[model samples]
Target: MTTRHLVDPELVALLDLIPATAPSAENLGQIRAMSPRPPVNLAQSSTLSVSERFIPGPAGAPDVRVLFYRPISAQGPLPALLWIHGGGYIMGSADAEDSLVTSMVSAIGCAAVSVDYRLAPETPYPGPVEDCYAALKWLSTHGDELGIDSKRIAVGGSSAGGGLAAALALLARDRGEVSLLFQLLMAPMIDDRTSTLAEPHPYTGEFIWTRQANRFGWTSLLGQEPGGPDVSPYAAAARAENLEGLPATFINVGSIDLFVDEDVEYARRLMRAGVPVELHVYPGAYHGFRMVASAQVTETSARDQLAALKRAFDRSV
Candidate 1:
């Protein structure tokens, strides 16, 4: 129930820019068949070589899709990032984020490996997370062959991708597997219980993620219900009571994002647990606000975020 009068000019403009009708379920197959960013078009750039393959997933589990973004200009042993693309873990592919991964490789000078893990409504909890773990494990195990610096590797994503990264960081640490150098999370959907009446706020009310979408995503992820008993912290990060021993984190969230409070709380817990964290909370911005190209703040956010990540990678490398 966002009142038109209460909306910001940038938000209004971005809303106007959106297509009136998005592809529906019935049109998805047709659209994918005709789309330019399909699996075959995995290498979206002539300047980069996009390697497509199926990486082994969790033990006894199915394989997961993965795409590598290696810049043509970059030489051997490039720094790498295991990126998980965000679409609420429902709809999104590495091809759709080709430009994004390319920008990261060019801007940060790090090779990017984008993971197209299993999505929800088909594969539930531990499915996507396990897929991401397998990808990371494979990345570490084969780091030398890929010409990536194993010690400088990081994990990142926006929204659901961020959620997966956070979970992966915890899982990686628990398993004593890869030593994660950095985690870049942008407006992540880290919590499934955000729609609780006990935590009502202005930020939670107006964002594109309504209470309904949260319910749908969480239900799909959990395969039964959301905000219920016996939810694991790895599945929904906000449920983690102990936040120690995670990797150094860089998080950027809009003040108006629905998960703003949870992000703030997570940062606080991370700090208290002696985990170094850098957090940026932008005002008058909503979740996915960085996607609005016409919005000056959105573009500014992109620049600042990219610069921060580049700095982090430089130091980590």
Candidate 2:
């Protein structure tokens, strides 16, 4: 079926604004130009205060930039969220997501730190993930100074950032470095193999984030061919053989998203491994359907995500 017929009508109009040509190695600049830039006046709440600072990145690597959002009225040491922005691992910056990150702080009354990790093609697998891990470590050790409750920390992101968040959870578990209270994986790009598949579910991958773009993203982030035998779980969480020790997870994906199948399977694996898991699959929604503010699904997605984060924070406390 065509994307228009399969996707939510509101999402269909939004998707129509973008050209559908697949990104390739030769047209990186074209693809970057086509991607969305953060708006000058992001819709934000007055209850939140925003700040930016540089923090220690990976050992020997340069410093990572982070944006902090906190409820102005809240007292010290509140729950915190470490956010990673998504642009298929190759594009996007922390500042691009300031609106959403700040809204999260206002809604949950929690402090949020959005990581400005090094993008791929320049900094691949280990570099991006390590930068995120460093940010997580920084949040943990310096929670007191940052007015965050060390014990109530959650890691989350959208699309490629969600993929990194998932990978970070695994890295934290394996390295015994940080204890994450929860994970919010929103339309995550978690499987390099997603693009390698010989065939996809008939209804998926036709809308925003097509199969061609997915392949480009995975390749860019790996700095090598993706879906090979030697891929690391720290680079792609779906590559992890075990999901037993990860924190409580919230997985949500649009029915028509390219990553829907992988996200659902990961949630199933997390549940089977005895980890607490919450999964939501919104019907008729395509990739980033939540971006259309007027769509009913967008409101539902926001409500569900906020509720999940609140529950995670409350339980941690």
Who wins the lDDT comparison? 2
Candidate 2's TM-score: 0.95
Error of 2 at 274 (Å): 0.4
Error of 2 at 138 (Å): 0.6
Evaluate model 1: give its lDDT: 0.78
Question: Per-residue lDDT for 1-317 in model 1, tens only?
Answer: 55444445687666555433333335444543553454546535657777887888889888888988787778768778999988776667777777778777887778888998888867899899999999999998898888888887889988889898998888888889898888888877788877554657754535566665666777778787677778888998878888888878888887767778888988888999998888888777776776776787777778877887777777864
Deviation from native of the Cα of residue 177 in model 1, angstroms: 1.1
TM-score for each of the candidates: 0.89, 0.95
Off by over 4 Å in 1: 1-8, 16-37, 40-46
lDDT of 2 by residue, 97-166 (tens): 8778877877889998899999888888799999999999999999888898988899999999999999
- lDDT, candidate 2, equals 0.89
Residue 236 CA displacement from its true place in model 1, Å: 0.9
